[model samples]
Target: MSSASSARSGLRGRTVVVPLIPCPRCQATVRYYVSNTEDHEGWVFYRCPNHSATGCDFWFWEMEYVAYLVDAHFLVGNQAVDAVGATEERREELIRASYERRRIATQVATSRAALARPGSLQQNMSKHQESALIGLGAEILVLLKLLLGSVMLLCALCVLLLMKK
Candidate 1:
């Protein structure tokens, strides 16, 4: 048997067994070692056994066969074995979204207040000045009415004197 074939057979009898599926990194046979086994539950991991020589250290959980474990759970604490960086990326996205929401809220509040009423002291002064001008115009109209009434009375007296002549 060739050296590679001999190595394959030697790996079969050991505690670790070669998986039916091939390794993703090396395309060689992936080896599975059952790290924990109880009567009710068991956990296994698959990796390239020739990782030291081939530098192909791809590993995956046995439970991941049903579904990708990292995607199903948001387990952020387990940094050792998480691939794809999904959890970290999700955390960053959430934080950015929160900040964006706050920023939008602030902008909305500012815009609403700006639109609702005059905020500046200068605008308030202008409004007051307009009201004062309207009041002065009203006073001028009252004085003009009194002056016209006096002029009409004086003209009537003059006509009565002229009739006596």
Candidate 2:
């Protein structure tokens, strides 16, 4: 079978559940869903399910440390193995990318706010400045209306001449 077909078949028959643990830094329960299996050598990362603005920042291995960490919370009754699951370096890369995106968003917001301040020409025009702009806009609208009316009149005259012929 082709690699794609084999991958599809593998996914169709995989059953794996990785228990989640609370964040050691913030003590919030993290939720995680596995998209791949252990036989495939996949790593599962925990995510805090709290509100986006105030969520805990914790993630750890699903196989070994998760159960022990849960026992330490006193919710679970048993301690498990000490072996830590292999860490995925991609997790740190993803976190760094998220932070960079947030930094850029903050910078954009600050620049826009600075541009919208009172003295900036892009925002908060004086009453006289606003009136002048409104007057110019009205004059342009009147000219457009007259131009359209003239075009319609010329079209009507052309049609009348064609009918007369």
Per-candidate clashes come to: 0, 0
Can you write out model 1's per-residue Cα lDDT over 15-50, one digit (the tens) per residue?
Answer: 211223456566786665554433212334556677
Judge candidate 2 at residue 116 and give its lDDT. 72
TM-score of each: 0.40, 0.31
Against the correct fold, how does model 1 do in TM-score?
A: 0.40
Error of 2 at 131 (Å): 2.5
Candidate 1 ranges beyond 4 A from true positions = 1-84, 108-130
Off by over 4 Å in 2: 1-31, 34-88, 123-165
lDDT of 2 by residue, 1-165 (tens): 112111111122342223444555665656653435423233444456563657554544444334445456522332222122222233354457667767998999998888777777443567668889999999999999999999999999999999999
